[model samples]
Target chain A: MDRKMSPETRSALEKLADWFRARSIWMLHYCTGCGAVELPPSMTSRFDMERFGIGPMATPRQADVLLITGYLATKTLRRVIYTYEQMQTPKYVIGFGSCTINGGIYYDSYNVITRLDLYLPVDIYIAGCMPRPEAILTAFNKLREMIEKGEANGWKRYEENKEWYRANQLKALNGEVYVTR
Target chain B: MNLKELISELKNKYRVLDEKFNDPNHTFVSIVPDQLHAALGELKSYGWKHLSTISCVDWIDDNEFELVYHLWNWDSRSQISLKTRISRSNPHFPTIMHIFPTAKYYERDIHEFFGVEFDGNSEMEPLFLEFWDDIPPMRKDFDPLKYSREKFGERDYKVPFADFIVEEGDQK
Candidate 1:
């Protein structure tokens, strides 16, 4: 049952892909680390995120994507979660760097939360201590595909397993997720 | 070139920008928490471009966390760093989110990290650290090392297996 599309069919597919890729994404404009210091250069004339219709938004209510720059602290986690919750449905999260993914430079420190996924559902996880602006743009493109396919809602699991997440949230020093056998 | 001229110009035109200090990279102007809005408005008129990056530093021993608004302009390769020290006890300040779109994120981050209240921030919740106390770490006195050592044990690492051959120095 292997059926390959013809040239005209492929051309239409390409056009659909381009349309999805061009969707405008508004950033919540949150930056919580030294990594955030690098964002201005990318959002400005250098990277020109506006060229793709991606721009910074004033409110989470209007954002299509939440970009967590780096190093989540516990107290900050509450606010990040709150804001993420406020965003309308059909949203995506882009974990900007290693710190957002796994606390790259701050792993040894317990005060900072290592994984951002624990707070909000992330669509594309870009890895690097401080990824270049190009990496961010690449992640945005990857997100467009995910958005079209609708796979970024993996966080639904958190809603489904509320007690499990709470238990993990309130766990003791082992940093363990579940309570016991 | 010197700070005096800049201070004089600002003082003459605007009644804001209190407690000015000369830092290596740029000038540090301490605006009283109340005057931040006016000061920012005046700065914006000169093409500050609303590059607001608000962050907090813990100064717990002093019962304060310094909230900084680092604004920059691409038009001119210069920046005017505005700072305000607020009491950690109440930890509230007027939200600059209205003046600059970028402040939405920056203020939300400060609110979450330091438990500092930005009166009208679009997002008042946390940013990075989710499971944390009201204790603000960036304050000069939050002692991250102490927090880490207490929460997690001493650093754990496997021993290195490489054996080095020592060579004597050519005469002590």
Candidate 2:
């Protein structure tokens, strides 16, 4: 009666865990920008995202995914970092809109950050000034596939590269970002 | 009373430096800084009850900062833009909060962006910006692009798009 499982058994257990995790994804309803406008349509009757077993969670503590919608101003970036860190492990980060990719129209803005991946590990990036509800659903399905494959491990990357992420966060926020608890 | 009568009334009491009717509903009246308090008080009593906003313009060439107080009269359905110029170096203007009461936040906003010191407004905290190190962002001399690149890192582009112009013959 050996307590430690072999590699074959471990992988099978992981697959089972991945299947459960893939089916149910609770995203934190933290709308950081204008891209939030598209979420209402997707969550409601028209797009009906609940059918996919993906829904918005009120707190970061319970969420499996953190959806960063549109531009992140330096002021808002600090709070967002805290939120990301607070979320439980096995978390995924979805960079929504072109703004999150390369700052979009706010590329040269004094306050807006250019690249989001510098501060956090992004699992996926949905392009467009704002990706439509259909695009959002597509991204969700893609995320589900990635989760099942264990490819969407941004949380693990963040944990491993914490120092690099912290330095970038400190630089953008002018040395004023601290995640307590 | 109508705008003409109101203008005549303001002219009699205060030294109206300049007056211009931009349209039928809007008028701009420039007055000396010294007469600002009294003039605003008089206008408030005469039915210009709404203090819409206080805006500032940095006139670098003239070495002056123009503070515009936009007031609206509900009864008359007209707008008055009360304008005053302060020395750019000094950048101090007495707060109109005592008269308008609503000028407190507007004055704070002006102080944050333009570095204007509203003398009596005590709550002149940074309205929008947080932990701002450089000079007031909205000032004429402050380069936003330079500040942005310095603070928030710029995206490094490998290709020089400027040099890659497609010639007319290349299209074919």
Candidate 3:
């Protein structure tokens, strides 16, 4: 006899897959620099953010999408990392603009951090000094599809390195290294 | 509410204004420091909730410095860039954080970078450059190249490299 599928088990598996495929997301409005200017238009009537079932979430705890807009000065980096950590399971990150990728015109900037990935995991990057509203909407649709496909596992990564991530978080929270010796 | 109407109103109100600069989507008004608050208040009455940033340009050759206040007005869907000038001797201005809460942070950043003090921003504190002071390097009068030359002490590293290659050639 073939061993693969029981009738009840197959139905449950199909439902679970559908649930993952319908994941609608909410983005946190966190912009540390110029790239933030694009969000207003993108989410407003110009791009009609509601069309894709994605909208801005004011707090990280309840959101799935964390859109980091631009230039993270060391001071701002701390706050950004804290916000990322606060985000609940199934979270995602969209790095917006050239500054979020490689710091753009601010590449030689002394105060801005050169790479955002050093601080948090980034799933999608929108490339531009300031990406157009259309580009942002496109990026959002892509992220939604990835989420539905279960390609982005925001919580699993956090679970794998909870301690290491906690240490990095603590260093920003207080001056101590946050490692248990 | 839009840049065109706002520009028209500002032109009518302020006497020290200069020629305006308009790009495809941005409009800037240049005014003396004394007129900045009044002009900004005009925008605030509309729906300008955000003070995007304060950019400073030091033009020593021209004997003046330019401060541009980039404001984001959500309702109008445009950035109203306001310009102001101050004497190089002692650049000072009233903090507009009273009108826009966000200005406080941008003002602090500008205060450290350009050494322009905001009179009413009590929360103004250094957010960068932990401990060190000379003239504000971003100031128009502050010559970073001169400072680099003086601090690093002029030296020719290429000459030594060339001499090393010449000696290697001689050996060969």
Winner of 1 and 3 under lDDT = 3
Candidate 3 chain B weakest lDDT stretch, 10 residues: B148-157
* DockQ for each model: 0.12, 0.58, 0.03
lDDT string for model 2 (B77-163, tens) is: 999999999999989988888898888999999999999999989899887877778889889999988887777777675557867
- TM-score for chain B considered on its own, for each of the candidates: 0.71, 0.91, 0.79
Window of ten residues with lowest summed lDDT in model 2 chain B: B151-160
What tens-digit string does per-residue lDDT give for candidate 2 at A42-131? 999999999999999999999999999989998788888889989998899999998988888998888899899989999898999889
Which portions of model 1 miss their true places by more than 4 Å? Answer: A1-22, A171-181, B1-172
Ranking by DockQ: 2, 1, 3
Q: Model 1: per-residue lDDT, tens digit, B1-172? A: 3345655766675545575555544677776777778878867777676575776777767888788788776675567887778887888887776678778877777666566787876577657653455366555546776665455324344447534534578433
Cα deviation at A110, candidate 1, in Å, is 3.5
* Superior by lDDT: candidate 2 or candidate 3: 2
Error of 2 at A36 (Å): 1.6
What residue runs in model 2 are displaced by over 4 Å at the alpha carbon? A1-11, A179-181, B157-172
Cα-based lDDT for every prediction: 0.67, 0.88, 0.70
| lDDT of model 3 at position B100 | 81
**Which scores higher on DockQ, 2 or 3?**
2
Structural RMSD, model 2: 5.0
